[model samples]
Target: MDLKDEFYSAVDAVHNNISFEATTANEISTFETSIRFLGGLLSAHDLSGDARLLAKARDVGDMLYKAFDTPERMPIPKWDFHAALDEGSVQGSPGQLLLAEMGSYSLDFTRLSLLTRDPKYHELAARITDLLYETQMTTKVPGLWPSHVGLTADSLDRGSDYTFGAEADSAYEYTAKMVALLGGQVGQYEEMYARSVDAAAKYLFYRPLNPGDEDILVSGTARSHAGSGAPWTETSAQHLSCFAGGMLALGGRLTGNKSHVDMGGKLARGCVWLYKGGPRGLLPEATMLVACPDAGDCAWERDIGVWHDALRRKYGTSKPVEDVIADNRLPQGWVNIYGGCYILRPEAIESVFVLYRVTGDRKLMDEAWEMWAAIDKATRTAMANSAVEDVNPPGGKRLRMSDSMESFWLSETLKYFYLLYSEPELMSLDEWVFNTEAHPLRRMLS
Candidate 1:
């Protein structure tokens, strides 16, 4: 099968099977809802030139615009991204990615607009991008916060107070990447994208989260640090893994920002140290090592294997890293429930691929295949099993599906999956990316 065909088949399985869209808002559906499924849909569309996925992405984007009806429609009164419209209105950081997601979708819509001359799609997308940029751009100390648009703008709105470092960083990365995606097509807007990312990196990226702290702290702000009242440290192995993976990509490929790469390496190394109980000052087993003071303190069993494997392989360990992971003496299942290890399987797989890409190692590929088998077996159930839910072995299951299933997850996850699996001759990095982004339908009708 051609690359496009294979991509389409996988995307179809995800779309028909996966419950949430790529930019899925758990219960709240107004945020960047269009881009939620765009990456996956775009991938499918690029492969088959099937208008269905393109139409679906456009339809969802249009629905979001209509639902918002106005800029007022986009903001939830309370700070909740997951709350249904009927449940309650929330304005907070959860939708930061939604804002960027919308930006990405709009950029794609712009492409469609240029290609097809569809003013409505093009105009709506531009408006959405403007609205999010206007609404989210902030001017606090650090500057730029991915604030959740308030639904009510009422006196009662308390707004979400805390933001993690990972989310904001991702938004920054997305902002730049999205712009770069279209800059070749639209010259002027590329600067806008560059400026936004530059601002984020300068103001938000360099600041210390846990000053004088043992673990290196990074905020996972869905927006800029200015938006989220307080910066929260992201301690979850999964969060770090994704963060490192993204930084590695952004720094290495996109902007050639070595600082981002260096920082990613630092964070990756720090995560390993923490996992190995190194840096004697701070205990690796401490649950609340950073801002996550209330999470599980023990090293997770199911995820530890994967996490340790990733860390070991990423750092180029000689023997199986699991030996050290196992020696850490973490309580069994400590990481399984609280840390959400299973949700990290794809991430671990991606990390292996990234390492392989950089180092040209075959062991990483072998490791990734092994990890994929575990994920396929344990998590791939037909109906409800589209997501990786935290399970307690024999019977217990965590019903709620976290944002881990979003498009970013799928995009990065499958990008690696296809890159590693597809024959090298069939893969051209630029062409592969283009297949996902450059389609006639993606251009709007002028």
Candidate 2:
């Protein structure tokens, strides 16, 4: 079959096999439970209007919406979607993928609200956004904390903190995108979005020690409130795929701030450093030490350890995991299904699509083509039922195609990918794809 056929077949396979009956079932695979993933596919079909695909996508959304209806005002994430959901409620936390597939599912669900024109979807989206705003605003430094609780003074607690690179809590990219698209509807939220983006750019994107290294930004930043609270340990910083890049794009669009645009550009170019020194032209998935002018011999073991664990689980721990596998290795430049490797694929694709839309540069198409080539080769699985692998360091295991899917992963990857190959204005890229599928289908207080 051709690419489109392969894509549709893949989606069909997941829709037929994956059950969204219970939270446990949905939580099993990262992709299987993702509302955003399905939402993106649906959005694509909505634009494309391929009835079969839309039917398949709509079924998944229906199941997910049903599964999410519970005592919790929003969907109770069966997996690691929320950072502190175990402790209490998080009204403002955007939907996030905590390890590729599990965590909050709010971001994509909100988009679904907009698409279906279901008042409940909008109501939930608003509620969730409001809660997140309220939770975050009270903090003296909202930049330091990951997410917030409800609106009331008592509910307002700055107890939860997100380590940078922890995909779930890094609301910059998720919220930035949310606000950029939806801010017009909620006039009051415009300021909150502006402040949130400012906080993230100031705290996370801008590095103090490596101030001169315009290319260098730590993947995450956080403080240990338990002990003497000092600057979040520099050693704690590491680089993950497109964390800064996505947020930069999100922040730029939300605020119309050129600085954010500059930051995004610099961050994208700075990614080259991660590529230049590695075994291949591949960037390290994680690094314990940021490239400094001075000392550089910090134990990067923790950074690679997480990679190794992920590699082993996805590809098997029997071999060394090279940072980036070549195109010949796998269809998507990865040897395993760990989301980190392919996580940035969509972001890069989205960035390319956005640039092309803005600049009409064939070079943007060239970039998209190059990225697609790597993705197509590195990740050969059907788009709907696809999984990635690590093949560089031979003797590693192969990850089976499973149910670990997410709406964010699908929406971002596919929509961006499709946009590169097709037109934009005529296309329907719904907000719900990102909110409901990518996040729990709920909204914060407005």
Clash number for model 1?
Answer: 44
Residue 3 of model 1, lDDT score: 68
For every candidate in turn, the CA RMSD to the true structure comes to 11.1, 10.0
What are the models' TM-scores? 0.54, 0.59
Q: For candidate 2, which ten residues in a row score worst on lDDT?
A: 437-446
The TM-score of predicted model 1 comes to: 0.54
lDDT of 1: 0.40
Candidate 1: C-alpha RMSD to true structure equals 11.1
Please give, for residues 1-446, the per-residue lDDT of candidate 2 as tens digits: 13787777766776577544434322433334444456555555644456655555555566555434433444444534333234664334323323222223435555555556666644654654565566565554553344333223344343444443544343444555555456455554556556755665554543312322334444445443434454343333333434455456445655677676666655544443333332233333443333332323223332334334433555554455553333214322122322333323344445445544433556656655655555445445654534433223444445333334544455456656666667644232323213322322222222
For candidate 1, write residues 272-311 as lDDT tens digits.
Answer: 3332331211112123222323223322332334444444
